[model samples]
Target: MENNMTNKLPKISEAELEIMKVLWSNSPQTANEIIEELEDTMDWKPKTIRTLINRLVQKEAVSYHQDKGRMYAYFPLVSQENYLQVETKSLLQRFCGAAFKPLLVNFLKEEKLSSEDINELKRILDEKTEENKRKDR
Candidate 1:
């Protein structure tokens, strides 16, 4: 993990994640812009969206800067990749006894993986295996 990802990140709720997704797709959007983008998909009121934004700001997961006279543009402080890493690690620790193989096997057995997906997983595992071999030398 990078240095920025090493620190504990503030927990983000599912609703808050919706706002973050919009910001992640395109950064520094005003509250109104975010609300507009989500309006078609979400039934939330503008005020409710604003409240979620406020919570994210308070959590330090999002920050804003004055874009024009009164409007502020908001962006995510946390990267999507970093957040996923933390969440994946937490899930593994909580339910998988911190073991990766069992979880991976379970997913492989349960999920309907396409040929491309299986090939990709094989390639990744092969690369990791070679890297570990070199390190052990």
Candidate 2:
């Protein structure tokens, strides 16, 4: 929810994000295995994938382990939900700023949400309102 998260986050670059996508989809893979498998989908060579893997490791986003002289695998340190929240909050803060009411008003005015979806949103909003009120004290 703060700029520090965006600015100092251990995030991978665009190229490395591809490897992360694979890691996120199927976690805990070795460098060689990821490189070999990624060739079918990505234009990058094995070395390229390896470089990305190294970069991801350095970023602390992905963790690795070794066994019997073989690097076993890696996994994402940050959950998808957390990552999504960070990105979405950044966008909202940048575009909507402190004018969330108007932002919501515009979205509600333009988008035709289903009744069920609206009800679900209302429920979520109620929970958030309760949380805000509790924090206000």
Candidate 3:
């Protein structure tokens, strides 16, 4: 793990994650803009969306800048990759006993992976194996 990712991170709920997704796609947007983007998918009311945004802001996951006419444009402070890493680690610890092979095998058995997917996994494994061999020297 990188040093930047080693520090403690704020926990985001499912609702807050929805808001973060909106910001992540197109950042520095107003609350109304965010609501508009999610209108087709989410049935959440404007107030509910605002509440989620506020929660994220309080958590320091999202920040806002002053836009035109007193409006604030919000953006994410944490990258999606960083959050995924934390989530993956937590999941591994809780469900997979901090081991990756079991989780990966479970996924492989559950999902119908295509040939491309299998090949990609093979490529990644090869790269990892090479790196480990280098370290063993």
Which candidate's lDDT is highest?
1
Clash totals for all candidate models: 0, 0, 0
Off by over 4 Å in 3: 112-120
Better by lDDT, candidate 2 or 1? 1
**TM-score result, candidate 1:** 0.82
C-alpha RMSD for every candidate: 2.4, 4.2, 2.3
Q: Could you tell me the C-alpha RMSD of candidate 1 in Å?
A: 2.4
lDDT of 2: 0.78
After superposition, the stretches of candidate 2 with alpha carbons farther than 4 Å from their true spots are 1-8, 99-123, 132-137
Residues 1-137 of candidate 3 have per-residue lDDT tens digits of 56455466789898888888888888889999998987778898888899889989898999999966899889999888888888888888888785789778888999998999999999999999999999999
lDDT, candidates in the order shown: 0.92, 0.78, 0.87
TM-score of each: 0.82, 0.68, 0.84
* Tens-place lDDT digits, model 1, residues 1-137: 58556467899999999999999999989999999999889999999999999999999999999965789999999999888888888888898785889888888999999999999999999999999999999
What is candidate 2's lDDT per residue for 19-122, written digit by digit as tens? 77787788777887788778988878888888888788888878887778765678877666566767666779999888878888898999999999899999
RMSD of 3: 2.3
